[model samples]
Target chain A: MYLAKIYVTYKPSILDPKGETVKDALHRLDYQAVSDVVMGKYFEIKIANDNESDVRKMVEAFSQQLLINVNMEVFRYELIALSTAV
Target chain B: MYLAKIYVTYKPSILDPKGETVKDALHRLDYQAVSDVVMGKYFEIKIANDNESDVRKMVEAFSQQLLINVNMEVFRYELIALSTAV
Candidate 1:
């Protein structure tokens, strides 16, 4: 099996209110050194497949089509072995 | 400046309904190879500090107390130079 780790983040131009809120909270909590925070989604998917290339294609297609809103978000992923992932 | 990328995930024994929902959706979308999905939170925090160790310490404190529910979730982070992050 292959493990696909995907990160879906907001586009640079998009303002993430959740991130801004977290940053503000951090500032209030005395973490003044924290200047900014960008919150995103992380997905760890286990694919029951062997071919790395095929797994990559499948992850790529699903991440874009089913996971992210292309207009405001962007995604990136890396594939690794299931055994090594744990 | 330093960038701390934090990944907060549920403990192995915890139940993640959202992850299971996503897995079901992926199967419906023809990604039959997808056997499992674990959804988590990703944080990219930009710390305007020069000391890597201090930045790590601050991130560790804030991530635990403010960002995650320590009882059910665990977090890991890696710090890198801001210039190298983007």
Candidate 2:
């Protein structure tokens, strides 16, 4: 089995209202030092396949097709092989 | 300045409907090799503070109070210091 840890975030040019709201809240709470807040999505996926290449392809497809909106977001992933008991 | 990259995810025991829906969609698309899909949040925060310790404290406080729902989600962050113009 393989595990893919995926991180997805908005492109720099996009406006993130959620992040802005959080930033305003932080300022309201007196965290004046905070700024430029951008928010996105994360995913942890367990794959039944053992082949690294195959897992990568599957994860990439998932990210592009279902997990992220490619119109405004970008994604990156790291794959880890899982230990199996004999 | 400091940049904090934060990841927030549901506890393993928590039910993730979003992940489940994605999984179902993947299965429908014939990616049966995929399973255990968990979805979460990612944030990129730029802080004006130069002090590493102060930035860490502020990010931690933000994570606890604003970034994550303590009842179900847990957060982790990495802080990076920005280069200052001499």
For lDDT, the strongest prediction is 1
**Model 1 lDDT per residue over A4-70, tens place:** 9899999999999999999999999988888889999999999998889899889989988889999
Q: Which ten residues in a row have the lowest lDDT in candidate 1 chain B?
A: B77-86
lDDT of 2 by residue, A4-60 (tens): 999988888888888898889989988988868888888889999889998888899
Off by over 4 Å in 2: none
**Clashes per candidate, residues 3 or more apart or on different chains:** 0, 0
Give fnat for candidates 1, 2 and onward, in order: 0.97, 1.00
Tens-digit lDDT string for candidate 1 (B1-86): 99899999999999998899999999999899998899999999999999888888898889888999999999999988866455
Off by over 4 Å in 1: A83-86, B83-86
Alpha carbon deviation, residue B45, candidate 2 (Å):
0.6
